[model samples]
Target: MTHSKRYQHRTIISFFTVLIVFILMAGGVQAGIEPSKVICRVETDRAILPAGDSQNVVLKITLDAPPSPAHIKRPLVNLALVLDQSGSMSGTKIQQAKAAAIEAAIEALTRLGLQDIFSVVVYDTNVHTIVPAQRAGNIQSIINTIQQIRAGGSTALFGGVSQGASEIRKKLESDYVHRIILLSDGLANVGPRMPEDLGRLGAALIKENISVTTVGVGTDYNEDLMTRLAQKSDGNTYFVESGFDLPRIFAAELGDVLNVVAKKVKVTITLSDNVEAINIIGREGRIRENQIEFYMNQLYGDQEKYALVEVNIPKSTSGSRIKIAQVDVTYENPFSRKPEKSTGISYASFSSDSGKVARSTNIEVIREYQLNLNALAQEKAIELSDQGKKKE
Candidate 1:
């Protein structure tokens, strides 16, 4: 071959190599950019309720983000697991619950690599601190302790919660997600105070910034009291039909709770007169001293999540009437706010009718169900008291 041809071939090869290197670098840069931020927005397009009438409305918001990345720092969790070891929770219920609690604790330890502090309280006629508030370093010991809980006596739901909350309060200085996980299968029957009085205690805990998540096991349990406790504390309430379903729910939910990226999430709503009533569902939005705060109970990864608010508007006349319900969500973010990645939601409604209007959501339904449960429990308490008097 000619020398000139050889030189030209070498030059061509060098240029191609440089081009390939550039392409590879570009690809790596693209791959290195973190995934898009996740955001959840829940709203209702139309909520119509009769004038001077009340109805329950449900607004279901779908969470569409991908699973959180594996390497992100999981939030610090100071958890108190309040288990109900009442006589009703014998056999399968107690066994399944213990297993599930173990699974959840292990998963949190392994997956998140979190410095978790946990307390286990099992209550029947009285509350027993199986594992006092302590850092969860030894997983096997915690699991073993949980497995040792056996069912006995009456239900002291209030005592269990109060004790659990007290334990959580000790860890308030850690800035961790302080929470009480209450599991119960029956109404309170042995506590010194009435179940309704527990609401006052729960509200006080909320003020102390301690949240409660209540889980109702089986159909006969008093879901009302459990739900109320959760709502008042700005936490979550769950229903488990059987023992077999306990582990998965506990693992998924406890992990999510521990993974909370933000705390003290506040949402404010300014409604126009055209909207008669508005209900914030799923999670209770509390009216604080000056501002409104929604205790965000779930973990969000790389994205913003939303709560559903349903508004009832008066029926429209010939002309359109516009009304705005501004929603402001404020949360603590560990990362600096990126203007390009801000998350929020704007919801509005309109009506021309002079009559009254009402609205509801899934949260509302749950809240009502909770109320009904409370009434039933109260009635049962009264009946039992009367029966005791008659026996005496």
Candidate 2:
């Protein structure tokens, strides 16, 4: 061949080589940029998985820290005030409880400026709604109802909460933040009184986009029950040693309720056909075939919520990339009063070479995984010690 023809042939070959390299790297690139609503990141411990092996994947979802008061546009609130009026809550505790409720009600009337709703239910042996849900215009009537409440009978903690929830249901609206704030200074001694029952009830309320925050005043209340109820409902739990602190805790709960930015947040993670989702660690989620779904009642101004999914991988050929899972989030944006969504995908490459897998390890994922393991170990140790077993 002539020299000029040879030079042109070499240039053509180099161009085709570069094109092939780009095509190979394209699969490693992320599908799109992260969503603005949340910081979602999917990380695997290593980039390459061994054939026929399983791996754990962590989804780190975070919202920016709580904004300043001036920056947050408070939403309309539908609040249920469930107060314990048993004999144990007499004197200072009951007086302080009434004060807290009044303070919270006054703030809603003066500062929120929205069409906020309020309901009051005080419980003893029986539960009754002192004030059914209404606009925050009747401050005098509410104060009178609260003052009439006198502590005497046995505690009907469950009954009071259920009655409060029913009151909020009467005026439930999509735009309003629905919440039940329960304050108790005594154990539940009447009606269906069980921690599991309260937890299940709290979980059911979350499905209706309502969260329950619990406040335990004094040491007589069941801390375990209070915490479980709040956790199941994605709400806050507070403990007050002094009755005087009731007002502050109530105010803090009101602040959190008004600062809600997103509601009805749902996360769905679908694993690829080649992989089987084994289980979800830490958080409770529903599993349908290979997909996992989690329902969150509300997302506050600053919070981080995440789930870790473990998957089993089928054997694959070397130098091939496989999609691990696709995560989609749907939420009601309070600012826009419309539904918004974000999507992300996770991928892992397979390699026969062990060295490549070692080099591609994601340090962040490994560190997090190790930390989770450490936590689990500590929990197990505590459990064993509680059972009267030696550490060794």
| Per-candidate local distance difference test | 0.55, 0.68
Q: How many clashing residue pairs appear in each of the predictions shown? A: 6, 0
Residue 381 lDDT in candidate 2: 80
Q: Give Cα distance to truth, residue 287, candidate 2, Å.
A: 2.0
- In model 2, the worst 10-residue window by lDDT is 20-29
- Candidate 1 residue runs with Cα over 4 Å from true position: 1-71, 92-114, 192-195, 272-299, 302-323, 334-392
Instruction: Give the top-scoring candidate (TM-score).
Output: 2
Q: Against the correct fold, how does model 2 do in TM-score?
A: 0.74
Q: Write the per-residue lDDT of candidate 1 for residues 1-392, one digit (tens) a residue.
A: 34433332232222222211221121001112233333545444333233333323333232333344444444466778787777666433333344444444444334443256777777889889887877645555555555555556898888888899878877877666777878777768886445467667778887776888877877878765777677678777789776556666565555456445555554555554555444544445654323333545344564445454455554544233343344454554422222212233434333334342233233543454455457658868977866747431
Query: What's the lDDT for residue 79 in model 1?
Result: 77
lDDT (10s digit) by residue, model 2, range 1-392: 33433332232222212211211121111233222375455667787776545545454433332342344345567788888767766533333333444454444444445257777788899998887887645454455555556557899999999998999898775477888988787899898777898999998888777889998877889876887888899888999885556556655776677667677888888888967877666666788998889877777776666666677777677888888888888887765577877777888888889888789887866666677768668768866766965532
The 10-residue segment with the lowest total lDDT in model 1: 22-31
lDDT score of residue 187 within candidate 1? 69
